[model samples]
Target: MSKEMLNALDALEAEKGVSKEIVIEALEAALVSAYKRHYGQAQNVEVEFNQKKGDIHVYSVKEVTEEVMDSQLEVSLKDALLLNPAYEIGDKIRFEVTPKDFGRIAAQTAKQVILQRVREAERNIIYNEFSQYEKDIMQGIVERQDSRYIYVNLGKIEAVLSKQDQMPNEFYQPHDRIKVYVSRVENTSKGPQVFVSRSHPDLLRRLFEQEVPEVYDGTVEIVSIAREAGDRSKVAVRSNDPNVDPVGTCVGPKGSRVQAIVNELKGENMDIVEWDEDPAIFIANSLNPAEAVDVIFDLDNPKACTVVVPDYQLSLAIGKRGQNARLAAKLTGFKIDIKSETDMEEFYAKLEEGAYIDAADEVETLDEAVSESDLTADEYENVAIEAAEDEATAAEEVAEANEATADQTEE
Candidate 1:
């Protein structure tokens, strides 16, 4: 390697984060192999890389041993002293064995080694760089696409956007810039693989965080998010500060803050609702625009609830195909069974009177009826015997009454 090559290394180090020291070490190793290959011998070898002069030197090493059993690998002290008086028995000596055409060989080796080193360094750098961005948001340009994946150019690296993670109705085109959620980063044999997503629920959360300062700073907290991708999404937010309106803060003046995010998501509908500590109220809030008349929890199963709305809101509460109710269920972590005023009138009337009747009670009554029915013959015989005994007692009483009447007439 020459000074020009060393300058390139320095520039590579600065630009690609590839350490010059690592490159130099790899170059030295490559040259060591080159020296042994050209020599066709296994003599102990050493390579020193001079950083200042940008020079590499190879040496054949021999130990100054008392007995020289292997002359190629060791030297006697008397022979070592002939070359240098300070030579010791255990000291090693170096003889410069650098080939005459070593520079040419090294030049080719350096080219290959530099390319390999830069590739590895770039991979490591990308891995370290993108790993920090996991679960975060990023904006990238759509570079290309295939049936299975779309490649997005993320400045230094291209991230894969799988078809599965894409928005349902969003159409992609070349050079279209879109915001994406960094779903994962992996270190593969080829390099670092970054997978981005447009359908993840966190994508909405991160978009809001980026647009709204209150959410990023913790004044407003995003309680939960449920997204249907390119169609509709619901975000439940709670304000730590009583003065801050979480939903209003996210909506911004004239609906600008949310609209910007909506535009980024290709006009996806967003419902930012205020989160309530009371799940009943929260579930009601989650079904926005369509007023919820009542929300009743299934105490037997805490994760389920039945929501009641006005007759007019039945279709609105359920959306075109239950999209609103589905997103509400996801956002509230409850199984929502939405009913209209006219739909389940009996159910609401029970709630209006402040009472609940278990359907299980009706089942128990039916069981009792089944047990009373189909009686045995022995049971019927016992009933007939009791009736005959009652009739005989009545006959005895009538005979005594007649006797009393006769005695009164004689007197």
Candidate 2:
């Protein structure tokens, strides 16, 4: 049994990568409990194992004292001196108490400990391996599905695809292979849990990296992505090289690269646009298939803007149910209020009308004040001149503001 136990330890270390010393230490502790339980001995005892011989020993430990208060825990100095002359007061001594049937208990304890260690070692290995893949992409096979999650086999372990992470338009079947983004990895009491996603915006970015050589090699950088999974997605890319066009590189020759990604996503539409440093230009580019006539920013809020498109392209810029405008806002990190050219014209017209009404009211108020004051002719004339000057200044300011708006729109 001793030789067999040593061989088992060697096999465990070689096969499972579990340290033999760790198993031996655990086995020794378990044997101590087994000794006390089986023999009904409540004495202070310890267990030791011989690494070379694979022999297990149990010993009763006692404190050497002048007067032994508890026989189970202490030994008298006179009795200890008989066994060993060097025994002194306050010293600890061990007496071998190996039982006749201890080998059987030790064998059982060793088996249980080895099995537990093997399981623990396997869990650690798996956790360490999968933790590195967090926030990355991997191809997995669909094994099965339930109401809550879809199980995907990723080489050694199974990953979970939750309901929210699954694409609505795609139906997963058993044994179907798919690419997934590793959103999170957690080490639980049971084992390692990997949460994967098909709808994450980063998944689109990774797909671009895989399909576009310029993106992978860092010549073209993906600025941002806005995706409505299973429907449509927009990607903004910028190029470091002056000669390379970021948009054309991502689109590929004859749109083959983007088409491959779209097919992989189950007919999801992709709009790849060039990223510009200017927020206005980038926002304009983000609204593809619909050209922006002007981008007017909100002075009070830097992240808010109004994108004015052609009157005919209002529906296209807003998309079906405002999806296009919503995605452009997300990609540009701006709060977008899309307007048509006609809308802007109507807005300006209302402003001018309001100003004119205010001027007329001021004139009426001046006339009322003059009639009530009974001022001399010269004083009244001076008051009239001041009012005219104020009106002229207000009109000039309004015109200048209008001119600035037009100049910005043209640029």
Candidate 3:
């Protein structure tokens, strides 16, 4: 070690944040190993570094014993007393055994140790920097692409955009900048590994936070999101302040807020629906472009429901290949079975006619039961008329409630 090496340590502490004490400790250990390897000594040795003087020293240690069995590791009391009068059997002594030409070896060893520590320190700094960004979003430039991953440069570190995380509608090229969601950050043996995604549902959520002040400041709260990357997504939002309309706030003036997000996602469709406390109303809202006539819950399964829509809007409510219903189910955390108005009517008719059986009863349809009973044609006609009247009245009440809900939403 020299004065120049001490200056380098100060520079490393200031610039790279590596502690001088840590480097000195590592250097001492490396010097001890070097001395034993080069000098071929079997004696116990210790290495120490003088921080002020920047000097390295190697010493041979031996335990004082009554009788010295090994000349290399033990010093007899007679020999120990010659050096120190208070020497005891268990006392130990050190002799300066630093080789004259050891400075050259020390310099080489110090260089290797400092370089290794610097690399490790840099990795720690990068890992700490990126760990804060986990589950957040960041902008990065595309660096390169291989068969498995697309490397994105996120300032201090290169993040990996895997095949599954990449949006199907987007293409990556060198120098192209894109916003990505930080799905995970890992400290691996090689370095810090940052995993980002373009297709994550939260990516949409974060974009809203960035673009919409109401969403970021907690005025409009996004309750749930269901996304099919590169195609369409549904977001359920609610308002903390009664005056704030969650959907309109998220949509911004003239759809500017959501339109910006759509552009970022490469023209992906967005359906922002108002979140309601009532599961029936929420499920109906989740159907978006399609109007749900009525929502019927399953008595046996609390998490399941059937949504009835007008026969003309059945395809729209179900979306193309059931995408709308699927996303709605995901958003509301329910199993949604969509049925047309006619289908629901037929279902009700079957129920009234005893076509559907209870768990404790034998399965029998209307015709089967009627053949076994002494029911006249006029009695059957009366039953049919009563069922029709009941169905009509129930339908009217549901329609009135739905209309009131729609009027309130519009206001």
* TM-scores of the candidates in the order shown: 0.74, 0.97, 0.86
Model 3 lDDT tens row, 43-139: 9999988888889889999999999999899999999999989999988899999999999999999999999999999999999999999999999
Clashes of 2: 0
RMSD of 1: 13.9
Q: Compared with the true structure, what per-residue lDDT tens digits does model 1 show for residues 191-260?
A: 9999999999999888888899999999999999988889999999999999998989999999999999
lDDT of each: 0.86, 0.92, 0.90
Superior candidate under lDDT, 1 versus 3: 3
| Of candidates 3 and 1, the better by TM-score | 3
* Counted clashes in each candidate structure: 0, 0, 0
Per-residue error for 108 in candidate 1, Å, reads: 2.0
Error of 1 at 67 (Å): 7.1
* Least accurate 10 contiguous residues by lDDT in model 1: 352-361
Candidate 3 stretches with Cα past 4 Å from truth are: 355-411
How large is the C-alpha RMSD of every model relative to the true structure? 13.9, 1.4, 6.6
lDDT of 2 by residue, 1-411 (tens): 487889989999999999999998898888889999999999999999998888888999999999989999999999999999999999999999999888988888888898899999999999899899888899999999999999999999999999999999999999999999999999899988999999999999888889999999999999889999999999999999999999999999999999999999999999988899999999999999899999989999999999998899999999988899999989999999999888898898788777777776777788789878989999998888877877777777778877987787687
* Model 2 residue 175 lDDT score: 98
Is 2 or 3 the stronger prediction by lDDT? Answer: 2
> In lDDT terms, how accurate is model 2?
0.92
